[model samples]
Every structure is written in structure tokens, then in C-alpha cells.
Target: MPKLRLKESLAGLKKIKININFKKKEKQMPIPPPPPKPIPRGLKIIEKYPLYEPFSHVVIVQNPKTGEHQYILDELQLDPLERGVYDRILEILLAEIESPKEEILDPRKFFAESAKKIVDKYRISLGWLPDVSWYKILYHAERDLVGFGKIDPLMRDPNIEDISCDGVNKPVYVWHRNYESIETNLQFPADEILDNTVVKL
Candidate 1:
């Protein structure tokens, strides 16, 4: 009877060892790492392209859970100091702009030249502006003066056909040729800005 009980205990111990070995083998198998999480509400960028060279770009993103595509404008982000300088330059340029003596054939080039002159004139007083800031400032000045301001990227996109905005603090939706209606990052945070944009439009 003692021998039988010892044999039974040894058999049970052997079974336990076999189970432990199985677990060890499982751990040895190469396990693929889990995919990294998407940020800012699970948005995964699928495609990116430049609309305006160097300064402005657009990204196509998909929501993993919803699989909805969105268009996001990515432009050079300007700090407060750069914005202040741009604002000052824009004000002076607007005041100094003169009507062309003849029909302006190349309006974009004309506005660009005017902006460059103002930037050069105030270069000393504005201190040393970084190259990125210079491009960004010039882009905004040209965009507002010659093209649409905040919605210039959307306006320039050949794929987009229509743009709609209900009111202030609302996301502007655009009709894309391929994606249909897509909500954009553009919105008027204040009434004054919206009014100004409307006047410009």
C-alpha cells in the first residue's frame, strides 16, 4: 500500500512537470508585438501630400474604429511673435497697396512682390526672423491678400468641389471628389474672425 501511494504521488508530480514544460515552450514561441495606438481620437494617417510647397500640406486620415476618412490641413505653425510681426506687416502693406496703372495680369506675383518689399523694409525692426517664420508669414500674407485666407488650402484642392460652414465654432465640411463630404479642421472660434473672413470672401 505504501509503494502504491508513492507511485501515485510521483505520477502526479510528473504530470505537473509536463504542464510546466508546455508553458515554457509556449513562451519560447516568437510573439508579434501589438500595433501602436493611434493618437488624437484614433486617427491613423494613410496619405499625405503637399498643396502649397514648403509651407502647407494635407493629410488623409482614417479612424480605425469607424473607417471614416478625413482631410486635415497641415501648415507651418507660427508662434505668437511671428504672428505679431506678420500682422504688423500685413497692416502696413494693406494701407500702402496702390491700384495698378493697368490690368494686373499676374495678381499672385504682384502680391508676392509687395509682401517681400514690406518684409524687407521691416527686417531690421522685426529682428531676425527664422526662415520657417519668413515662409509662413509670406504664405499667410499672400494667401489672405491674393487667395482665400484660412480656407486657401481647401480652395486650391482640385479634388474638393464644395465647402460649407453653418456658423461660428463649427467645422467646415468639404465635398471631395473621391471621399464625398469630409469635415475639415477649419472653424471660426470668434465672431469677429468669421466676419472678417466673410468680408474677404
Candidate 2:
């Protein structure tokens, strides 16, 4: 009778193990994958004007033709707080132009011409353009007063928030505080610097 009871107990243990294995296999479920991340609108600008070691203030411009963006540096190189002030001015200008009338102010033209005037006025104040032919003074003053290698006349304009040059003869890129970068629908050739100097002369 004792040996018969032992055999029954062993059989019960084997049956319980088999049931647990079957439930584990039957209850399994498939795992789903995670969702993908979204891309940022500003990434194109960021790529051109990459943030390097020293986090400088940057202005980004978009190309109208290709719908691409570029980045440039501001001449004043303001701190974060000052950049806020510049941004406010841009916001005001943009808001003013939202509903255009017959004579909407062309901000780009205004900024460019105004900046040139400031440079000319400065030259007069310094007596740098004295008696020299007006045309000669206008042409050379830019080179004489501002350093020739990298300086830009547009930098004088308060409205121009950023400027960049890949090479000479290349379309110099500008960031108007109110309007992002103006593409100019132009590009400088690979040897733009050499081409630009010859043309300027």
C-alpha cells in the first residue's frame, strides 16, 4: 500500500509541471516598438550656423528659391540679454508690415540704404572724404575706413542682424532681424574670393 501511494504522488508532481509550461506558452504576448521622434523646423539654419565651442549669437536666413536656410553672425555680437532687445525691434517691424497698404515700407531697402548713409556721414565727420571726387570717395571709403578683408557695409545697419561670406563673388548672406535671412537667390563660386576682388577693382 505504501509503494502504491509513492507512485501516485510522483505522477501528480509530473502533471503539475506540464500544466505550468503549457500556460506559460499560451499566455505570451507580442511587444510593440516605440514611436519615432519629430524633426525641428530650425534644423536647417542650425546646420549652417552650427554652434561651436563658444555659443555665439546667430542669425539664420532662408533661401526663397531652394527653400533652404543659412546662418550668419551679427557684427555687434551681443550677449543673450542684448539679443532680446534686437529681437523686439524685429518683432515690431514684422507686425507693422502684416497688413500691407499701397506703400508698404520695404525694410530691406531701408536698412541697406540707411546703413550706407551712416558710413558716409561718419567719413564726412572724420574728414576722410575731403575734396576727393565724390564717386571716388564713395567707392573707396568702404575699403579705407572699414578693414578690407572681411568688413561689410551692411554691418552698419541696425536692422541687419547677421552677415556671412562663404567666399567673394558669392552672394553674401544677411539676416534681417525682422525677416529671416534673405537668400538673394545667389551663391558664390568655390573661388569667390578671387573673383570678388577682381570685380571690385
Candidate 3:
């Protein structure tokens, strides 16, 4: 009788194990849906201005509904000295433009010409120029000063309606036209630097 009872207990345990296995199979999560593809929109290239060099450009685009957008394609990263040179030239140009004058020169022409002249004069005065591309330096200076500073490209993006950053070392977030709110690649790693950049806008 005891052996028969033991056999019945073992059989009950086996049935419980089978029931748990079936429950586990029933509890799997459903597969998530795939992300949406980029929507096709008719875009017109209105104008393209060179940014830091020939490698990258600041493009002005018009959409089908007659909306303008700005895009920076393949940005040119600059060294510290080159950055300083750009800032210096921008300051000088802004001061010159602000000075009381009968007529204000077109920013596009003024910046392009000023950059060429300033860079040449600077190199001659220093007696030694860095192993850097002068045209690139001038191009960036003109764009930042005459057009838009650090956030010029971001501001021009019609897709991005609002821009915000939480803190230093944090990626800036934008309200993208397609993606909604998303983090951007742009960051100002330091608070002071971020403050200065915002001041420009």
C-alpha cells in the first residue's frame, strides 16, 4: 500500500511540472512593430553655402509647401587655434558692421571679403601660418558671424521647431518634424561654453 501511495505522489509531481512548463510557453511577450521609414517629400535646393571647407556645406532647401529649411551636411571640425581665429574675425566684422555707416553692406558679401582680407593680413603679420586651410577658416568665420553662429544650422531646420539642452555634456533635444522629440548629436560640454553659444542666438 505504501509503495502504491508513493507512486501516486510521484505522478502528481510530474503533472505539476508539466502544468508549469505549459504556463511558461503561454507567457511570452508579443513582437514589437518595426520603425517607420522616412516619408518622401518634394524638396528644392534653394542655395548652398560652404561652411568650414569644401567637404561640408550649409544648404538652404525649400519644401513643396514653400517652407525653407537649413541643413549642415558633413561638418568640418576645427582645431582650437582655428576656432580662436574665427571668433576674432567675427568680432572684428560685427564691430565694423555696427559702426555708424550710411549704408550696410550685404552680410554675405561683407563676410566673404572680410574673411579673405583678415586671414591674409593676419598670416603676414604673424610671419608664420599654421598648417591649416585658410579658405576653411574663413568660410566658418563667415557662416558663424554673418549667417548664424553655432546653432545656425539647427535654427534653420524646418523639421526642428524647438531646441533645448538639459545641461553640460548632455545631447541637445529637438522637436523633429518626423520623429517628435529626440536627442541630437550636438552638445556643448561646458556650461560657460553653452551659455556663450546661446548668447550668440
Candidate 4:
């Protein structure tokens, strides 16, 4: 009798209805990058090798027309976002980086350690950056700070005894231990760039 009463009372209640809806937000996809341009006929790469593993490489090229050989230093290139991060990190390091404690301590090693800390601290502000970009910025920051700015790879190379730049828009020349003297593909495109190179050196 109680069970029948319960069923009769439940049947007295009205049926419930639910409205369900799902909406997805639209996302704008990134544009595809342009294809690489072809290498010009004037220059041809003879040999290529890594100078700093993933960060830097060296390319030897010769002009077929002039039979002139040149050395090119290929380093990791950062995009706009990565470049911005690199610039900011460098600015902070330049102001706050510590000097060597002892004369015997390697300045490069000390600076690199400090710079790594700064990079780690600054990375918090940079959200969703890829490792490639992060490493590119780090490499550039270290390159500009403790290491030689543009020609750090060349400096590391034991074969080259001397490096020289004549003037703006002129190729830098390196006195290779084996090849003697040869021009480098690195050239100062403008007067200010040449001045900056001098200051960096």
C-alpha cells in the first residue's frame, strides 16, 4: 500500500525539460612563412661545418666569377618576438651582470652562469615560447655579453690567427693558419654598423 502511494505521488509531479547548447570560439591561425629564396649564382658554398653545435655554423663559399673565397659565420636567427626577448635580457644583463671574483676565474663562464639565471627569471614573462626560440635568444645574449658579439665563432676557430675589416661595406679578412689570408663574407653594410663592430671588438 505504501509503495503504491509513492508511485501515485511521483506520477503527480510535472516532467522536467533541459536546453543544452555548445559554442566554440573561433581562433585565427598564423600565416605560413614565405619560401626560401634561391641562392644567387655569384656565390657558391664549398664546405659547411658546425662551429657551435646547434647555435653556430661556418660556411666556406667562393665566387665562380672572381675565384674569391670567403668565410661565412651562420648563427641562430631569432624572429621578432625572440629578438625582443633577446634584447631585453641583454639590457638587463649589461646593467646587473657581475664581474669575476678572482683573476683566475674565467669571465666567460661567470657571465654565462649569471646570464642563464637572468634568462630563467625573464622567461616567466614570456609565455608559450618554443625551445628553438628560447635557445636562439640565449645564444645571442651570451654572444653579445661575455662572448664576442658577431664573430664569436671565428674567434673560437683555432685555424684563424687574425681577423680584420678594412672599412664599411668591405669584407672582413681572416688570416687562416692553413689558408694564410682570405676575405670573410661578413661585411658592414653601413657606416654605423662598422662603427658598432669596432666598438664590439
Q: Number of the top candidate by TM-score?
A: 1
Off by over 4 Å in 1: 1-39
Poorest stretch of ten by lDDT in candidate 1? 14-23
Model 4 is weakest, by summed lDDT over 10 consecutive residues, at 1-10
For model 1 the local lDDT of residue 166 reads 72
lDDT of 4 by residue, 1-201 (tens): 011000011122121111212222223223232222334578987777656666656777788888877777765577888777777777777777655444534555566567778778877875668766766676676666555566666766756777787666667778766566787766657665444445444
Per-candidate TM equals 0.74, 0.26, 0.49, 0.70
Better of 1 and 4 by TM-score: 1
Candidate 2's residue-wise lDDT over 1-201, tens digit each? Answer: 011000011111110000011111112113221122223454444332211112212445554556776544432233354344334433333333232223424423343344355545444434332232332222222222221213333433344555555553556656655666664323444353333332332
Candidate 3 residue runs with Cα over 4 Å from true position: 1-74, 79-108, 127-132, 143-148
lDDT of 2 at 144: 23
Q: Where does model 2 exceed 4 Å of error?
A: 1-135, 145-151, 184-201
Worst 10 residues of 2 by lDDT: 14-23
Instruction: Residues 1-201, candidate 3: write the lDDT tens digits.
Output: 011000011111110000001111112123221222222357665555442223343444456584644332445556676666666655655554432233344545544665566566666653444544455566466555544444545554545566776666766666655545655446666555555455443
RMSD of 4: 28.0
Reference-based TM-score, model 1? 0.74
